[model samples]
Target: MQITPDGNIVFILPAGPLGSLPISATIVNTWIVMTILVVGGRLITLGMGPAAPASRWHLALEILIEQIRKQIQDVGGGDPGRYLPFIGTLFLFILASNVLGVVPGFTSPTGSLSTAAALAICVLVAVPFYGIADQGLLGYLRHYLRPTPLMAPLNVLGEISRTVALAIRLYGNVMSGTVIVAILLSIAPLIFPILLQLLGLLTGVVQAYIFAVLAMVYIAAAQGDEPGAA
Candidate 1:
């Protein structure tokens, strides 16, 4: 067993004008996770009939949707319908990626800083996008200068800092968990590692929830609403 759980390079493209580009295990695993989510989503939504008695899968999906809607409404203080799809997809993708690490040969893409950074960048962009959409461009830009024009640079810095924090927080947790598990396997009994694996699974779920919630909070803030408002 390896002492360090670094991502393996799966393939390297020939050097071009840009340079040789290597696809790492994290990228490959992320692709797998995306494919799984897309196919599973399609399968789950197929052949729906409103008049028919709901199957367990359908019922569970309904409950999940309702819960997400409620959470968005509570945090964002407006109609939740528009935000549902983006927030739901973020939760499910992260949840799936984290859980996939439990499999024997799979590593969570989130353990890689690059992957985490990419996800954070998406949220960073989305926050501004939604803010500008909700408030006009001038309205959204004016917030940075509120109270005083001198505070504008500080406000911009805060946004950048938060985006960096979001990436690091998720990457640190997932990577540390991965490293701890690897270290345990190297020095501890197999049974102990099994227990740690179980704990890691629970932690993975919690991390996913926290990441999604934080993203929602940031979005709500961008919308100029109290994050805790109903």
Candidate 2:
């Protein structure tokens, strides 16, 4: 494994049969991120008060809550505040993991397929759960067969495809950026690497935004909203 200038360690995929194991530095980093999402997010929620305080954590969390609330309102058009906790946590975790690649000795958990796939799967499952809770199971499933009974199978396929696409899109984008920069740094250890780093920063934010937007879309769809409605 070689450490890049960004401080991310790169491990080339192994060639042999043992390459498919679930355990790796990537997996470990993902577990740490998961822990942070659960523990840190819960603490933030538990500690929040209607009265304002000057604590940095509360201030930062307030900004995050506002951002998530706006995003949900823009896309969902309902009580976005209610979903802000989970949606905000998801956004923060993903944004953190994506940006973590810039830190030394840290690999972006999102650059790994397993991690991205796991997150996408969670979003997929959560949609149905939230939908059932909000709209009832019958209403949620009725959405699948909506407008035309013949399109139910296609709707099901579309749902699964969106989840797969979310995973693959994030994995491919981050992994490709890392690989390209590695190649560039190997060939020329100069100012061009800095340009690549700048580009990575932009790409990281875009990927995070795309993931969050798609997640809202899934949740909106689950609630029987028209695709173009929101």
Candidate 3:
């Protein structure tokens, strides 16, 4: 992946296997990683007792729990506990999937538009549904119309655009990383790609964080938090 001065992004990877299904390598790898994350996270958390986290697994789970809890509190303010479950699950799932992608021959699901779009859609739908449910339809609409009448339509448009932009941003970042590394390796199978691979690792983690953080921000904004709330 190449980063441009104007903040443009580029990703490269092998041409996806062409067929009726169009299920590319990245898609398959993403599904596998996400499946493991879901199943593993469930098993790990399930083993934890209700009391203070005693075991190593429980302790790690507690740290993740605290992180999500803190993010919700920071963004959603009063009674944000209601959003804890959804936000927490999303953060952990994405974090796990992303880290798993750094493994050799694996690709970040967030690198694919399909995966990112699915996640973005979930956030987009959840935000407004939760907003109206919590604040009432009238109040929710009012929030959109606030500060000015004309800005309401624009604000709503921005909300929709935000979801689309979020998906593209992540997809571009990860896919581009994969492409650049492939190109470097093709040029010369040497120590250079090792450094690039490390860069890929960092990129994966950062992109995951950005996606998770933005998901919370979008939800918070819809719930009437100030702009840049998350």
The best candidate in terms of TM-score: 1
Q: Which stretches of candidate 3 lie over 4 Å from their true place?
A: 1-27, 50-53, 227-230
Angstrom error at residue 152, model 2: 1.1
* Residue-by-residue lDDT tens digits, candidate 2, 1-230: 33222233334555587664334677668777788777877886674676745577878877877887888878876788767766776677788787777665667888888778988998899899889988988988998887899999999999899999999998888888778877888889787777887788789888888888788878977886654453
Poorest 10 consecutive residues by lDDT, candidate 3: 2-11
Q: What is the TM-score of each predicted model, taking all chains together?
A: 0.93, 0.81, 0.80
Computed on alpha carbons, the lDDT of every model, listed in order, comes to 0.85, 0.78, 0.72
Record all residue pairs in model 1 with backbone atoms less than 3 Å apart, i.e. clashing: none
**Where does candidate 1 stray beyond 4 Å?**
1-7, 14-20
- For model 2, the stretches where C-alpha displacement exceeds 4 angstroms are 1-22, 34-52, 226-230
Please write out the lDDT profile of model 3 over residues 62-100, one tens digit for every residue: 787787777666766656577777776666666666676
How do all the candidates rank in terms of TM-score, highest first?
Answer: 1, 2, 3
Q: Where is the poorest 10-residue window by lDDT in model 2?
A: 1-10
**Each model's total of backbone clashes:** 0, 1, 3
The residue-by-residue lDDT of candidate 1 on 28-100, one tens digit each, is 8889999999998778877768777777888788999998888888888798887888888888888898898
Candidate 3, TM-score vs. the true structure? Answer: 0.80
Given candidate 2, what's the lDDT at residue 222? 89
